[model samples]
Target: MSELKLNAIDFISFAVAGNTFKLKANLIGPNDQFHSVNLDIAPDEIKNKTIGEIEKLALQALRSA
Candidate 1:
């Protein structure tokens, strides 16, 4: 399969009760189309993570989808 590329990330919302943040991941598909994925993540999940690391995660999610 062709590699998926991470395009951008947008903040959707935060659930204070659950302590989770919602994010919209924008990716470039293998066919050059844009794909959007919504991810719910805890703040700790991204703490101290570099941009490259986060990009890798996004790409992995795209591939799985």
Candidate 2:
């Protein structure tokens, strides 16, 4: 099996709360400050979705957050 390496310059995390799933993107500011954005996507929204579809939604959410 091949290991998948993501060239992510920022931080990301996945979490679940009850029936909703949360995706967060963390950033470091120029002054070494920390900030984060959270996107809560319902399970049904991404259910049965393709990898590409999910990725697209995730990126969109990140941008909006």
The lDDT for every candidate, in the order shown, is 0.73, 0.48
lDDT of 2 by residue, 1-65 (tens): 01222122233233554566665544444445454445566778746766555445545554565
| lDDT computed for candidate 2 | 0.48
Candidate 1 segments exceeding 4 Å error:
none
Model 1, 29-51: lDDT tens digits are: 66688877777778888567676
Q: Which ten residues in a row have the lowest lDDT in candidate 2?
A: 1-10
Q: What are the per-model C-alpha RMSD values against the true structure?
A: 2.3, 8.7
- Per-prediction TM-score to the true structure, in the order listed: 0.68, 0.37
- lDDT winner: 1
